[model samples]
Structures are given as structure tokens and as C-alpha cells.
Target: MVAPFPASFLLGLPVRGSRGERGRRPARCGPLRPPPGAQGSCSQRCGDQSGPCSCHPTCFGLASCCADIRDFCLEISPYSGSMMGGKDFVVQNLNWPNPTDSVICSFKDSIQTRGHVDASGRVHCVSPLLYESGRIPFTLSMDNGRSFPRSGTWLSVHPSKVSDSEKSQLVNETHWQYYGTPGTQGNLTLTWNTSALPSDAVTIELWGYEETGEASRGPSAAGVKPPTPAGSLEMGERRFQYDSGQQCCYTADGTQLLTADSTGGSTPDRGHDWGSPPYRVPPRVPGLSHWIYDVISFYHCCLWAPECFRYMNRRPSSDCRSYRPPRLASAFGDPHFVTFDGTNFTFNGRGEYVLLDAALTDLRVQVRTQTRTGSEGSQDRGTGLTAVAIQEANSDVVEVRLGEGAGVLQVLLNQEVLSFAEQSWMDLKGMFLSVAAGDRVSVMLTSEAGLEISLQGPFLSVAVLLPEKFLTHTRGLLGTLNNNPADDFTLRSGEVLPPSASSRELFQFGADCKGPPAGGEGGTALGRARWRPAAVFPGAVQNASSLLTYDSKFLAWGWWPWLGSATGSYAAGRATHMWNPGTWYPSFSSRVPCSVTEDPNPEL
Candidate 1:
């Protein structure tokens, strides 16, 4: 039973007051996994802290609990919950203001959620959705699951099926599935029953993401059911026209496929881009990504759904495909961000900032930004990514930096600089690094580290692909990955930055995560000695254009650049702002400016 997507991608309204006080979080804590040899020798038992660390429900906040504390020490409230996963699942004993250790909830072993200490000081993540019924194996990981202890606790997924009435909302939900393993591109299969005919030169319009991993990226969330996640890639949409008897429709750009095959099943690179070529799908970003799945459909998508399926109601029994692909979280541009939980927002702060800090694994990422003074002499108003530094538990600090101009870049591993004098590839540890065509550095940290970092040319635009472990093991500017956006701005200090924070506040907030001073928890990397100034335009004059705020309705994140006009930064404006004029059939206005921001017209 899938729950509805958050309002973010919908009406483009503000989420400020929409979440209520329940969203408020107490200070956060780092992860507290058991010591290295603790899990290997320690037997399974509560109150057995004598073996290593103290084991108690209260000890969790202090990072002194046993690995299986959640098994016997801590407890969860409401043992039973709906299969849909929106209900709050709380840890009863672990008090709030947990400063040193974090709590992780494991649903069976497939899904993990980061639990937060609420205003009441209890740890929790909204309940989870389980396709199966009855007592499911549920456990806790005080150390981010280094030892899940499958022998521990349970959560009952209510067996009751959602009544058709209860599922009415799902009828209007967006249903886009990702293609699976061993396939690059595939065919777009539109299956319909024979009873209804394509009698009137019917045309099929297919809308699904082209690139691999993650969804609702780049484009405005307007007309989309769920608002687009923050920091998504900038991508365009593709359109195809099909009259009767046309074997195939030409793809807009001819690179990506909608699905691997008609039935939407995974196979070994069989069907790649079935009908035609791909269009408007951006390349995959590294570090800032993951692999979760969800569904959302806005007014534009909803209005057209009925027409597309008017005569094709039957889903073939053979089409029963089970697809649970990994989801991605990324940050790029100047730069927009899609949090681990799909929260989208733009951070234009300058200086070195921590992208995310992973617990257990000790993987830390810090990025540097440089700003350009606009024609208005707005010093440091326009910012661009300059470098990205990645450090894993045992790995060297890998820094990929932009060169002097648009076509050069430098790669440094710890203090040893890697010379790619020209376009070349070098294998480091278990990962591969290459200065590819177009002044870009691609760091594929797969197999050994679940990360892929892509730093573009000309001062660079960066993207990272996150691992599934990131869900409950990370924090920083990218926010918590618990599939809950309400706390997306949660700072490492455990403070949740409010949506109403001014530009200066936003700048300062990001600066704080540069990671505690050297010798502190997460020390800075090479070439990063002093933290960048909190203010980008230090002595520059400031006004409304630079201190923009989020809209009232859908919280479409409206951002005012440091020195430029705030014009289209408000995401809500996309609701009425017409998309590419050439993409729409039966075109209305070539481009319709939003009539009003407060109350947007669903019909463009």
C-alpha cells in the first residue's frame, strides 16, 4: 500500500506551517555502532554491556549502548501500524536531545530509516510500508546497523487490505517505473485490451524519466503530482506523436529508453530503447543519490491521465513485474539539491561546505564554491562549484578541482596530485578516476565505495550518487535520509534550519557544516585550512532580490540570487509557467506566465 507523495511537487505551496510542530526536531547525534571487536565476540543479550560498551536504553543518547540495544534496551511504540508507512513509529525509552549517538530502524533488512528525537525527545521515523502482513522482523541499530541482530524485535504490518475507497487517491497517482539491471535503454510499450480500438488515429504520449536512477529531477514540479525534489538536474521533456499504423516514433534525441521491455521486467541488456531514441534525460550524478521509489501526479499529469488510459484499462496478468530499484539523492548546479528523502532546495553559499557525513563508514564529503560578481557589481552574488573533496573511512582525501579556466581540472589524492595532463584514466584503490571529454572529472567509487562523483567543467557543477546505507547513516546540508522532508534542514549540530531563514542565515547555516575544526569530529581535508567566510557578498549592498523566501502555498522553494533578480527562482511559478512550447500537442499559449503566485491556475 503506497502512500501519497508529499505536497512539495504538487501545488507549489510552502511547507512551513503545513508540517505542524510534529516536524520539529531536537538536537541530532552521530551514529554509535559497537566497537570493532565488540560484535565478533559479544553474545546476544541485554544488560551485557560488561562485554564492551554500556547497554541501556538511556545509554543510546550517550553512544554507550550495546550493538543490539534496540533488541532489549530500547522500545518502540504502537507495535502495530498500517502498511502504508506514514504513522509515527517511536522509540519509547531513548530520551530526546540525543547528542552523541543516533538511532536507526530496520524494517526487516531491506529498508532502513533514521529516527529523530522529536519535541517530546523520543526517537522516531514515520512508520514504514510492508507488502507482507503479520509480525515482520524489525530491529534497531544504535550504530547504524553494523550489527542489526536479526534475532531482535518485531513490527506488525496490519493485514487488512486498503479498501477501494481508501485507494481512490492512488488512481490519481503517477506510476513511472525504472528499468532494471543489464540494460541501458529499452522500448516504450503501451498495452491495451482489444475491445477498445485506436479508431480515430489515436496518439500515445509517454512520460517517464529517461536517465538512470531517481525521479522528479531538474524540471519544475508544476503539473507534476509531487513537487520536484530540490537540487534536481536541469532536464527537458520529450514528446512523440503516433498516428495509427506507425511501427515506431522517432525519439527526440535518440539516446535513452523508457523501459527495458514492454512488461517492464529486468533482463540482461536485451531490449534497449525499444521504440526510438531518448530525449531530455540528464546524466546520473554521484554521491548526492540513492535508490527509493515513490509516486506522484500533479494537475497537469492527472488531467491527461484519464485520456491516455480511457480505452486501455486492462493490465495483463503477465505484466505483474516487481520492481524495487534503488533511489538517488544529488546536489549540483549553483547548486540545487535533492535530499536523501527527496527535499529540493538551492544553496548558493560560498566557501567549503560539508555535503554529507556518513556514520559507521566515516565517509565525509566537502565541496567548495566560488562566486562571480554580476554586472551590477554584486560581488560574490553568482556562485559556481569550484572543487569537491571526498574522504572515506580508510581512503585518502580525494579532491577534484576545476582548473584556471573552462577546460582544465586538477585531481589531488590527499597531498599527492594526480596528473591527467590530458584526457586519461587512473585506477585508485578500487575506484576509477578519469578526466573525460568536455572538461569533466568522473570519479566512479563503486564496488568498494558506493559513490560516484561528477564534477563538470568551467568552474564545475557537481553531482554524487549515494548508497542505500546513506538512508540512516548520513546528515549535513543534504539533510537526513529517513524519507521524511520535514527535517531536511537538520544541521549536524542537531539544529533544524527553518525555511524562513534569511539568505545570510542560509549562508551561515551551510558554513557551520564545514565540519568541526581540525582534530574535531570531521576534520577539514587538504587545501581546506580555514573555513570560507559565512557571507559571500560581505560588503555588498543587500535588498529583496537577494533575500528571497519560499512561497506560502506549496513551498515551491523561491530563491533570490545574491545579486541577480529572483524572477523564476520561486519553484511555485512553474505551476503556470508553460513548459517547452514545442513539446505540447494542441498547444495553447506558447508560454503562459503565471497569472498569480498565491492561487495558481491548474489549466495552462
Candidate 2:
């Protein structure tokens, strides 16, 4: 008599949403063993479209129907990552539209103005019409922009275009509007004239939240209540102290506006120092980049507790440890170093490069050189194959793509590959391959593909083992990536991530920290270190899935528990590393000092 787990699988994983809706899409997870290319012979989409049986879209965006092979260890299942079964797991609040003030008419209208809200709230506004080439499609005005209530219309996948194609596809909710299309670049296109309309109504929303669960079947009947998914505490590094009372803006050569000194240097640019005089001497565009608030501040991370990976019985916490080994990270500019080209190498110029070969075989490449060919084939295919660069020149460069392949596989900056193919392999087996640090590197292999390819020494190895809570030399909390915001795991401002780079849901984010959780201003004293592959907790204890995904964009999955045959031999399930963090947590207070919290103010 045990079957009841769906309260949305105890309200946890599954929270997808990226905005920009055409079809909206978001829910997907089908084929587990049926789609490899349609497997076996012919099913012809079941409807039999002649005799080809095609279903691939990743078998429905990537199989995993959960048929059973013991569910692949369900990843050490406690509940087996269950977002209920119905799946939706809600949370959305878009609202949008923040233009701020009023007037802005230019397109020879003569630079009209009157839109302000700057003091930090940010709302600059302006619209004079500058279409030098093509792009300016602003549509939203209860009257303001002068007359624009066309209300959604831009759906043209096919109809041949001349006009009516189903319409409704406009985008540009706010930011004044200007993206290239009417005369290009200086874009300013509009011809509305209905006398505008009723004052204002530029809403434009997209919110999120859709949790629906009902399929747990056990452990107390009502279902789903194994939640201890909150924080995996322990964080450091914040350094930024400097305030002598305020009012500081250096640039006479000492450089200091947003502060960050050690002599790193950078500043100037806000109207070229506007009217100049608050300190003097401005006006230099040599390479122009000015505007340095002196950045780089993160080191706060947490939220990843799908039971924290259970270990039970005893003997495990040295900090978690077990797989990843071979360190030296911190290079790519300001910290870069991971090179080795003994047998093949070549990349004259351009940009973007990253190579970390633990060596396997067959992966050689090449580009732009027969003596630097770039003067004929239309400059050798426009500036010598600026698009790709190989396969008889012109442009095509290296590509072996896949995350699910077919499209999205790019390369350049001296392109070349010839290790006898079979896919050179760089799917990230062990770890490390981050780009953007000088970009423009090279390598080669073309003697019959260098004999099929084989070179295990220059270092590029990866076995991919990261599940013991991160196995540590210490320096806790490392989970975050929610919507990314362009930081993408380099976290430093408030840092917190003990074991969760991104389990993928596009990249979830939800987990707050303020100390032990009491009414909310807590700060300091957090004891929650977790890593349950079955259960293990020996020192410190609140790494509840890195604080529930960084404070509740919520997504701390890992719940597999359905093994009931007594001892037929597949049981191994039990991981409960909980820490909820705030609906309760005071058990007497005492010694609690793991402070540091403030990332959008825990969402206010």
C-alpha cells in the first residue's frame, strides 16, 4: 500500500522558459529507446508517409522515457529526479515595457526629445529615425510613438511575402527601438495614422510558472515530500572595500571610477566627461573603450539539493573527492595556459581559440594557406574563406558538431582538420575547454589523416568525473547559471557552488543565503555540505543543491526511487541531504557564521 509521490514531485525540477514566443514550446521529453534515426526499419511516422518512417528531432528533444535499465542508476536515485510526471513546475513574472518618459521624434523631425529617468533607474529614450541601411520596426503606442497599434503581425514562414502571411511577429518591447531594416542601420520606418489611440497600453508580457504534478505512488500515500533541497553553503572572496565617505572619479592617469586598483587601469566615457571640469583633461578616442567601473566580483554560490547525493553508513566526507584530477585553470587572458602542438599547428590570425587535448586520435585540421591564398577566388572566397575555409578552399572550415547535431557547428581562425575523421572527439569527457581569450589558434593532420591519428601526451585528457560534491581541496559553493546573464560560471561577486555547474533546464537559478535562515537578515553560520550518491554528510551541512539553484528559480533534480522487489538486487536507493533554509531553521542557534548574501536581494 505505498503509492503517492506527485505534489509536482514535491515541487522541484522542471522550470523551462526562455522568452520570445513563436510557438512557445517548453515542454519536451519523449523517446527513451525508440528514436536513434527511427530505429530498426519503417514506421513512417506511424501514419506511413510512403515508406520512410522518420521521427528524429532528438526522438522528441532527447529521449529518456524512463523505461528502465535500472534507469541508469537513476543517477543514484532517491526519487529519481522526478518533476512529478505531469511536468511544468511553474514560476514566471515578465511584465515588460520600461520606456520611462515621453517624446522622441527624429527622422528629420529634428531631434525631438523629452524622455528621462536616469539616476540609476535607467530609461534614456530617443527616436529621431536614423536608417542608413535597414531595420527599425517599433510597434507599441497607445499614442506616444505617434500612432502604432498594429498589434502583433510578423509571421512569414511562407506565403511568398507581399503582405498577408498570417501576421503577428513584432518584437522590441522597449529600449526606444532601432535594429536595422528600413534603410539599414539608421532605421526609422513608420507610417501609422489612426490618430494614435486611447493614451497607453504597451504591456508585452511572458511570465512563467506552470507546475502540475500527480504520480508518485508511495512513501505515505499523498506523495512527493522529500524536499531538503536548499543550499550547499561555504563561500568566500568579495574584496572591494574603498569609500572615504564617497564622491570619487579619477582619470588624470590614476584611473578610478568604479574602483578596482592595483594599477590595473581603466576609465573615462560618459559624454567624454560631459562638459569636462570636475577633474580635468578628457577627450581621447585612440582605441576607445573607456567606461571602467573596474569589474570582476563574484564568489557566492549555492542551491543544488535534490537530497545532495546521499551516501549513508559512514566513511566519505574528506570534502567529497573521487574523480577529477589535473588542475591548472585560470588562463585565456588575465590567466591563460593550456598548449601543446608538437606534430601539427598553424593559425596566422583572426580570433577565438581554445585547445585542451587529453589525446585520443584522428583530429587534424587546416585553413588559409597554399601560400596564404586570399587574392583570387574573390579574395579566395571573400577575404580567403572568411566563412569556413576548407574542402577545396573558398570556405567551409572545421565542423563536426553535435549537442544533437545537424546545424550549429562552426569554426575559423585558420581552420584545418585531418586526423582521418570519425569525429575527433571533444564532447567534454573529463572537463575544461572554455574559449574567449585571444581567439585565433591552430592545428593540423593530413598525411592520410596522420595515419588515423593518435597522440596522448600534450595534454587534453578528460574522463569526466564530478559528482562527489565536487571532490575538494576546499573552497565551497559552486552552483549557478540561471539565465546566465553573461557571467557563465566564473562567479566571483558572492560565489556559491559546491557541485552543480548546470544540470540544464536552459540554466535554472533559485537559492538564497543570509546565514541560517531565520526571518531573513540572518547572514553567517551555515552548515550544509552535501554530495549524496546514496548519502554522505560529515562536516558542515547545507549545500542543498547549491541553495536550491541559487535561491529558487528552482531546479534541483535527482529523484529515482521505484525499486521494489525486496532484494532481487536493484535497491541501492537512499539520499536525503536536506536543509530547506527558511520556513524553519533555528534549532538553538549557537555557532552559525557562513554569511554573504545579496544577489538581486534574494529576489526582493
Candidate 3:
């Protein structure tokens, strides 16, 4: 039994007990005050009572009135109300480093959720403050700081135990270090293998505390500085911008491409671990979370490949010179080999070709080219393929073919149109399409007396999937095409001629023809061409509302770009769409009243 102090105290006091021990009341002795310097005069609580109590255990305001001679005492107080002893001591503030701050692991490759990241290079923290004290007892809690259990050595965070907030936010807990006592200075080191992270995005949260000495108290819990992050992960925030025409989201600071998946009628998913079985973004229509193609002009037409040309007739005219204004096709071709979206197709010479007739204030066109190739037999029959042809007004079609042509051919139609003599054949094989608006197309090609053919390119937003290293030329091409101002291409002898004699002319059935110098007006060079579909940005919140409205003289249009909020601002520029001509320029703003510019839709 523990030692008992001298007591001038009163016992034999009567106390009350609850029915069936449901509620036990405490017994209290009459008030007893010790004189100054009296030994063991400490007034402490005794007996097991429920709810609030001071030094002495009592039920409500009534002290125990028990009349027993034995003095009952409290064995252990889980939550102590007061400090013991008459001496005062101060616990030093340890100023320890937070264990969570230094804990991080960025996976160089995608990590599968719950997949064990081998202990090699995984983040681990050992508190110097705790070790310096030799043996400081501590507890660990996986369910945050709510509860703790005794722990020695190290703590591990399995990806499976990741909470909804952590998973949704892509956060991971590699390890944490803690200090058990106050007044000790300490530091923690965290290290992780970034190559082991499951997803590209991640976040982490950590917390720790030190117990004050018997007589000391630190600052309130609210004033604590959070853990400092370690490794390559930064501590800033991220933002995004939406290009409606491209149907994709771009990082604001770096303009990096971001992938999106539609979730049909529900919110689209982001930040899911890539290694999860059959992981995918939400389907653009419903429960699906993956997309085969992102941007499809009209229906299946893609923008990543060479821009195909289609001839449209405003009216049925026997003369090819009386052509219609240009417009984009409603269909597109997928590029791959062996049923994997092949990159090549057979050419036909009989398809219709159109002329602007008059120069365009806006040079954008909506040309309808057959995006899909027909069966092998149909290719020979010219069912869905055709050649791009042109004819000059009042010129002999046959004479121009033999180099004995005479007449002023139509040149530069907005800096991209090609000039042609009546009935002359121009080879379009292996040519890259590029376009620049606001120039005289007829004059741009007038200097090339040797059958000037221009590369008229159509612009469409697309995502490049090749390895990062291979994207150099592709990225340069895109940058030059998009208002880079300093870009120019010049053709050299025999440099850009079509690959084979059969591919040289639009009509393989026609007579032999040695192609002329492959350069248009202004010395524009032709490069090899390849085609692929464009990627579209998935909606942030699906089918939010209609962004476009139409009627008579008054039309209403919204600036919603798939996943963007109604209040975002985008830089002003030309916009592209399948049903409209290439010249359409639609402007949008988040806060300003919707004011209509020239109707961007082409005359379909």
C-alpha cells in the first residue's frame, strides 16, 4: 500500500451510492486547513466520482458524508486536473522539425495504388529530439491525430489506408518523426524516391507535438507552424486555362498539355492512380473514363494530320474557273498503319475544286475532303479519294500542260492560294500544309511562272503523343504556324518532289509529266505531311449548360470552353470549328456583356 500522510482530517463521513452501481456518489470530509509549513498538507481528490471534480472527489456541491474510517484514494487519473508537489519547474521548448514536412516521394513513373514501394529510397524520418533524450515514449496514429498507440522504430503509410481526401487530392504519407518532450531542439530528415510515386500529382500532411514538463506550458495548439515539405515537391498552387476550340486544358504558368476524360452526366475524374487496374478518365458520354479521340471536326475529321482539301460547288458550272468559296470538310482520316489509322491514302483527280472568285475578308475555309479511305478496290475506283485541282480564267487547259502556256494566272489568294493554268497537272504528293492570313494570294504566287502551287494549311488544336524527345520538330512546326512571325520555309531543287512517278500527278491514269520546280510564290517550301486526329478537353462538370444560342438578327453565344468556369478570361484570337470557314474569329470574355462580333460561321 502507498504511504499515507498525517491527517488532522475527518473520516467516518457518510457518502451515497447509486442503485445497482449505476451512478456512484463520492464522499467528502469536513473542511480541513493546514497551518503554514505543515508537512503533507496537500489537498488532493479521492474516490471514483463521475463528471467534473477538483482536488477532492464530490458529487455535485455535496462532499461525501461517509462515516467510514478508511480513506479511499484515486489510483491513476487519466486526465489530471492539477500539478503535484509544491516546487515549480519549466519545460524548455524543443523547437523540433516536423516529421511530415520532410516526408515525400515522387514517382518517376506512375505508381499503382496500394502497390508497395520497396523500402529502397522511400521517405523515412527519425526525430533527433527523441533520440537525444535516449528513451522518450511516444504514440502513433494512422487516423490522423485523433487517437494514438505506442510505437517504436518507424511508422509506414500504406497506399490502401489513404483517405478519400488524400486519394482525391493525390496525397501520400511515407513516414513521420516525432519529439516526445518539450524544451529540446531537434530536426528531422525525409527522403523519398520520386520515381516510385503512382501519379504525377501528389500532396502530403504531417503533424507532431511535445509534452510540456511537469510545470511548463508551450504556446496554444493553434499557433503551431506546419511541417516543411522536402524533396522536389513545391509548396505553391496550380491553375488552368481552357481553349474551347482545341477542347483541352493548359497549365497557366507553363502551358503544359493536360489530358481530360468525360464522365457523361457526372463530374469528370482527375488524379486517379495510373496503375489502378484498367484505370481511365471518365467517358465523354457515360460511365466510361477513356477517350479514343479528343477533337473531331464535323464527325471524324482530325487536325493533327496534314490538312486535306475538298472542292465545293456553289452552283453546277461546266467551267472549273467559276469556282465556289472554300470551306473545310465534315469528315477526317485517322493515321496509323495496318488498321491502326494508316498515314497514307490513294489520290483521285475527278473531285470538284472551288475558287474564292473574290478575295476573302476572312481567309478561313471549310473544305470537305473525304477523311476516310475506301476499300482497296474502291481506292482504284476513286470512290472516297480525290485530287486537289485549280484552273486559271481564260487559259488553254491543254497548252498550259506542254509549257507553251500564255496568260496571267491567278496568284496569292490571301497569301496561301496556288496559281494554275487551264488543264495543267500539279503534284500535291508529300507536301506539308501551312497557312498565313492577310496577304494577296494571287501576287504571292505570280512570280513562279513554272506552275506555282502553294501549301494551304488548315489549323486544328491537337495533342502530340510521341516521346518528349521526338517532339522537337513537331513543336517547332506548331510554334511557327501559330503567329511566330519569324518563320519562313524555302524550297530547293529536287528537294520536295513527290516520292514516285505514279504519285507525281493527281491522275495516275494520265500521261508522263516531269513536275516543275516545287516552289510557290515568295519561295515557300513544301515539307512532308502526316495526319492525325485532334484531342478534345473533357468537361470539368458535364453538360453544365448551353453556351450558344441563335435566332434572327440577334444571336446569343456563351464563352464556355468545355471545362472552364463562366468567369475565366482567355487571350483574344481566331477560333476554329468544323462547320465554319477557317476565317471565323469569335471573341469571348467572362465578366463582360456578350457582344457579337462578325458571325464567325462560314456560309455553309
RMSD of 3: 36.3
The C-alpha TM-scores of every prediction are 0.33, 0.17, 0.14
Which tens-of-lDDT digit does each residue in 59-127 have in candidate 1? 333344455454344345644444434445566645444334555667766666665555555556544
For all candidates in order, the CA lDDT equals 0.41, 0.20, 0.19
- Candidate 1 off by > 4 Å: 1-324, 373-379, 421-423, 446-458, 513-604
Write model 2 residue lDDT over 337-400, tens digit each, in one string. 2212111111222111111111122121211111113235232211111111111112122322
Q: Which ten residues in a row have the lowest lDDT in candidate 3?
A: 1-10
Give the Cα-based TM-score of candidate 1 against the true structure: 0.33
Identify the candidate with maximal TM-score: 1
TM-score of 2: 0.17
Q: Which stretches of model 2 miss by more than 4 angstroms?
A: 1-142, 145-402, 406-533, 537-604
Q: What is the lDDT of residue 9 in candidate 3?
A: 9
Best by lDDT: 1
